[model samples]
Target: MLGVSFLPLKELFLKNFILVRDAHIEFSPGFNVLTGETGAGKSMLISALLFLGGADVDWEVFSGQRDEAVVEALFVRKGEVLRVKRTINPEKRRTRAEINGSYATKSALRERIMPLFEIHGQHENELLLDPSTHLSFFDRATGLSELQREVESLFERKVELESELRKRRKDMERLRQIRMLKEYQLEELRRAELREGEVVELEEAIERLSHVEALKEGINRVLDLLYRDDHSAYNKAYVACRILEDLGRFDRTLRPIIESLRGYGAAIEDSWRELVAYEERLEYDPEELENMRARLSFLRELEKKYG
Candidate 1:
């Protein structure tokens, strides 16, 4: 059998005033009794013990006297010294605990105190009448060990399954959001039908059209120099040829001039042919320009829709 022992309360109070001051009690391995007259602090001592166990206490017990109240207990259990301290303020009232004089918490104290001590008050008789609390009371009264083990095992399994269920629910919610975003992105990409290298092709076409005016002006200047009215290169070339032909019989230097005139005449003729071809290419096609404009407009609309 497991053994338990409790040391006496070192100090206790209802408020600033002390109730049980520096009191000590030692219990053996059997029954014990705490008996006193009514209103003689027997019930008060029990209440203090109850407070040490994780029970709530009413603030009215210390109403107008003082704001702070304290109760402290010492225990010697299994060769280890345990200290319990409870403080009550107007705003908060609970137990503070220590093991081997090291600071602990009320929950820690309760864990050690539960098996060592069990308080059965007069109100405990009411459990005999209540069917709900009856079975547990009988189990405790008879020390039914195996049933307690089964209940504890089932309780632990239930907690573990509940924790897993909560985690799965959170994972499912995260996956659902990810799937929705991917589906929307896929739909947008499908509707656009974006083709490879389409952007590069469109950019090249736009660059060519952007320099259209400059290209046309250059071509016109060349054409004018070759074939236009009075200052044309072709007219100048014809005049040079006539002068060289007249001087060719009179001077030897005029033979070189005649040869130069023939070369200039041949170059001008070739330039004239190239100029006609350039003029034909510069002629605008209305249908093709309209198609380019429509395609750019459609691309802009799609970009806006997706964006």
Candidate 2:
């Protein structure tokens, strides 16, 4: 199994400034303290330690001095050394950091250093006086990490299940639409009495009926050409017969021409009789057209209802 390690501060230095020439200290795993006279630089040492762990510092306090500060730490986990260093230049009021003698970011150094140290100053006494903060510390001390991990795991599972449920809901909606369409189609088919091949039959019937007026006009024109008042087929054939008979003595072929005219006259007479019979059958009943319109309207209504 693998284990994580934490870095720890080991030594700090403040040279030629702030009522101290040089100071060095080694820290242990347990609690440590600094006690000295007033203006002994004890709080300064603590501030320097805080600054090394990415805490903000007031450069104005060390103004007009050669403000050189260095902090070094030996990080031990299971008795192994991981070193960190930080240096500050008072002239520029800027800080620099290194990890294991390699240059590093202040944020990265803070991440490595914060887990190993907890600082409590006079302000912490006020926090201890607050019941909420005290209760929070109690809760945190009492194995809250396990509860937090469980909550996080459950939250992740809930998110995944919610996504799956949304997909299922979408699928169910599609099925419902399909079912509705089928139901409407079934209802329309039942109400309209539409047979399997009824659409083709009705279309053909409608096409024939829609052209009723044009058909009637064409039939009337044929009837007039065959048996009208003056320019009729019968009158034309009769005139042709008379002409052919007058020329029969001049040419023998005129007899056959007269016979052909007689045959055409008979054919025109039969066609006129048929046209009168068909005209009687070509009557348009509006009720049948209204029934077809109603059937088509019913189909369109069903499409709108379920489409």
Candidate 3:
């Protein structure tokens, strides 16, 4: 029937609420009463005020389309505006509140805004139903509201401490998980012995080892073609030069030809000797090759495990 405030409650605004899509109610400077017929939303307005004061919400209070229900109130305190707003999200099955446009927890809303307005309804929240809290109502009747607030403040402080304890427990649990992960990572790297540039070096070595047999065979073929038999390039070149020189006695015309190809035969002989020297210097040690193969195999194992 009437709402009271410690400071002036200037206005209340509601939208998409039950039985009324939108409405704005302005309070005057003194005692006031809301006069409306039955089923005219007088009770709805009271329910909205109670909701803003942190009462249990009934989403059935939602109107058409059933999106969201908003209840906002403006209060004057020390020449500053204290705005309290509550929104009901039926889709999410949750309710949220704000004080001065900043998010406020449910307990914070209960502590901060629940006392701004008092309602005497026909609901079960009466002194007869719960006589344990009768002392608070009696204190108000006797103008002991300040003392009642002190008691409530102490209760709120207890609630805050309990909330902080719960948060710290969560933090401790999170730290435990982080420690386990770091230990696991340390063990893996210790086992892997991962090092800088190791992957690149291993890759290059593996490439070489994979093609090593082919490399040896190719070099052997080059040596054989140079001087492995008398029919080889160097041997044949020298034989032609000598036969032409032998024919020079039968005909002097062959003499010029012999002289011309003599230098060519010598060039081939010199090139073949260089090839023999290179073949002698080549390192074709099987033990070293086997060692390289084992290293490549070890590197492959490492790649599979770490990667």
lDDT of all predictions, in order shown?
Answer: 0.64, 0.69, 0.73
Model 1 stretches with alpha carbons more than 4 Å out: 1-53, 57-133, 142-145, 200-307
Residues 15-97, model 3: lDDT tens digits:
87666678888877677677878998888877887788778876554433456878898887578688989988877768889
* Position 31, candidate 2: lDDT: 50
Q: Candidate 3 lDDT (Cα, whole model)?
A: 0.73
Specify the highest-TM-score model's number.
Answer: 3
Give the poorly placed runs of model 2, Cα more than 4 Å off. 1-121, 124-147, 182-225, 228-231, 242-250, 255-263, 292-307
Measured with C-alpha atoms, the lDDT of residue 230 in candidate 3 is 56
Q: lDDT, candidate 3, residue 189?
A: 65
From the highest TM-score down, the ranking of the candidates is: 3, 1, 2
lDDT of 3 at 173: 96
- 2 or 3: which has the higher TM-score? 3
By the lDDT metric, which is better: model 2 or model 3? 3
Arrange candidates by lDDT, descending.
Answer: 3, 2, 1
